[model samples]
Target: MHRTQYLNSVNDFIDWFASNLGHASLFAHSYIDRRSNPAAPRTLAFTTLFDACKQYHWKHNGAFGSPAGACLQTNDAALSALRQALQSAINTVNDSKTLTASSAVMSWGGVRAGNVRWLTANSKGLAQTIASVCAALDSDNLSHPVLTSCQPLRFNAGMTKVYSLLVNDFIIYDSRVAAALGWIVVKYCQARKLPAVPRDLAFPWAPAKEAANARLPKNRDPGLGNYHFPRLISGELHAVWNLKAGWILAEVLARASHNPFRNSSTVPALRQLEAALFMVGYDLPLNVSPSGVNSEPESYAEGDWTECYTAARGKLFHYRVEEGGIRLLDGRFYPVAVINRMLIILVELFGTDPFPLANSATKVRVTPSIPGIGYAYFQATDERGNPPSASALAAVLHELGVLNYTPDNRAPWALDFGDYVQRGRIDLEALLKLESERHDDVGELIA
Candidate 1:
């Protein structure tokens, strides 16, 4: 959180959209490819990237947008459904004296029952917090008066969704959105060639469902100490940060009045940018080097890799088998899955074979923790299972007799899947290219 008093950083943020639209495009393209290449953000026109990212978000984001392709014609349906459902639930419940816990939970299913129970258990606190939010909505000074509950409430992760429904222009400030937004701010500071990132732009990150550096999209660059984001806990701090983000983004949109999204396209809402950030946020740097931070990822031919779950109909994602890893259609080569030994992984669509790092012999990892930076396991998944498998990486190994699993096991994991990863000639070449091309940034002393 160290920083200099760089007051112009906020204006520079707005200016990023106004003058740096092309760079924004590049950032957007590279942002989509972050799962494979986190350290480097690509360059493209902002207008083009804006559209591409929306489609990407629609395609992959677990219905944060849609389950593929923006396609213009079908883009508004899901968002409309989400907004309408929540708006209706909020507007009709007791004519809006306060957002009841019942209506809030009904609007956003992600709210934990325990949090809802807590709100229900204390009516006074919920009413007070709702009033505080309403007051902020009415105020001109977004940052002066802090937004916190009278009670020790820490359900901002869930309640924000409810509040987003009740309040206009608020977004679901989850871990992904927070991480992506922070990364964007860091990039703006870097592009402006600022001496250091000021505290005003330093947004904190919250760990997702898993512990250990889920490596859920962060700055992998070491020298940029002033820019490194701190982990955020969910409570008053989270609410304050969420409000700040909303305010900052609102300013950016308002200031950048004629920025493509406003005039010709049906895409002026704040949610479009939110959806874009959610997609790009899913990635982190695989390798970073001094050759230049924004190296271009290898280009995959149209038919290089088959789309997984094609039988799932409109569920479309195509990938390429290349030197670095299995590159998704959108240029995402994430470390999603593994054979279970290599630091627990993150295979998104297909199973890949890239588990080169060894686990600590002294440590015993709990199954399904998704522990480390690792490889992918590819398998065909025609049907999404109960609790759903990330990729049917195990099914491939099971058929080839490389590993085994049971119906009782939900994830593609086994207790004794062995420590070492074996690779054939092609796989080894790609793994070698992964090392050569990725140019990983580890072991360097921080500046």
Candidate 2:
């Protein structure tokens, strides 16, 4: 397909989808208010696209954008209309005649402002090349070398799987999504607009002091713990102590009194926040023993740990301090979903933008510290200074448990295109190959 046709299809699809999404948002608000509870309409605000699909009626073979979509059924008329709209939008883009060419122009203008550059390799070594020479003859200011040499460039189109499977495609990565949703609600309230009953609206639960204290006890004494608790002192005495004990000590004292943990009131709020995230279809463990901690404390034990765990459905979090800039920690790397969920919620309240390319349609999600993939290992120098063998690399990752994700990497691409046989998410044939499985659906759903 031609570039112009491809762009037109994509633009049209976005227009249709965005328009339908606006209506869906309003319908969702009304559905929550009328059917569930009138007072706490915002309770269902974070319902995911998948959750919405299930709540309404959406049927297909697998994840969104998949071709086997006609199999699904829904009894609800309005929901059926919405699902059809989404499917039509996707179909219009995929069926574009302009994108038919095997090799199409890949524009980076949205991301790099025409100065975009990527490394290219050859038998000799990697030499910086422009995208213009790599493709057909194109504008110099707005293009790079044409990247047509197959073995020389070493292009792998399959890398897109990671972007779709790991990254959250929702535009909500930026605060715009939440702000837009919130704006809809605020407008409804201001205009006294009410719609039909909500299907799952209820009074959003509030945390209680007793419940919060039950999970973690308050420590008034600073000496007994690593975190110090503050005590009241007069301004003159505080000034004198600050001068004598150093600025660090005085800062610690002030932080102990004001920090979220020391405040005590935040415990219940955290607990309630945890509960709400769980409700929104995130897989977060309620309570789990921290690694290396003994099974002695009331909160620390195997029995106390909840079996709740869902992979792919992890949380995204980003934070910044005066010293450190924006950093995102997607919780899928953790063994326990609870820890992941906690970090997710904690960051949402205190976190910044989750990833770069916050507004683009094709942004890559970074999987932090993934063993063997991100880091390069060179054990011994070859006569000509060559890289290590694949077998040696695999051995190193195996020893470090980098290759072995706790849930076992039954990822999306393997089923969709790899050797795994059968159809549907977690095809029965695929399960037969596994010894035991916890969250295979995680790969498909997240993808």
lDDT of each: 0.42, 0.21
- Candidate 1 on 1-447: residue-level lDDT in tens? 101122244666766755544353546434334324457745322244366444542221112344323343344444454555545544444323233333323222333223433343344444555555655643534443444436554445556665655565566676567756766666777777776656777776643332123243233222233455665666667666666677666666666745544454565457666666655554434323344364321111122233333111224454433443344556544332323322232233123522221122222133432332212222111111111222332322222123322322234344222222333211223332332222121101100
| Candidate 1 lDDT score at position 402 | 32
What tens-digit string does per-residue lDDT give for candidate 2 at 173-197? Answer: 1011112222222333333433421
Give the root-mean-square deviation of each candidate in angstroms: 15.7, 27.9
In order of listing, the candidates' clash counts read: 22, 29
TM-score list, all predictions: 0.48, 0.19
Off by over 4 Å in 1: 1-9, 22-25, 28-48, 56-114, 119-131, 142-150, 153-155, 211-226, 263-268, 286-447
Worst 10 residues of 2 by lDDT: 107-116
Best by lDDT: 1
In candidate 2 the C-alpha lDDT for residue 186 amounts to 31
Which stretches of model 2 miss by more than 4 angstroms?
A: 1-3, 9-11, 23-124, 127-447
Global local distance difference test of model 1: 0.42
* Candidate of highest TM-score: 1
Per-residue lDDT value at 142 in model 2? 15
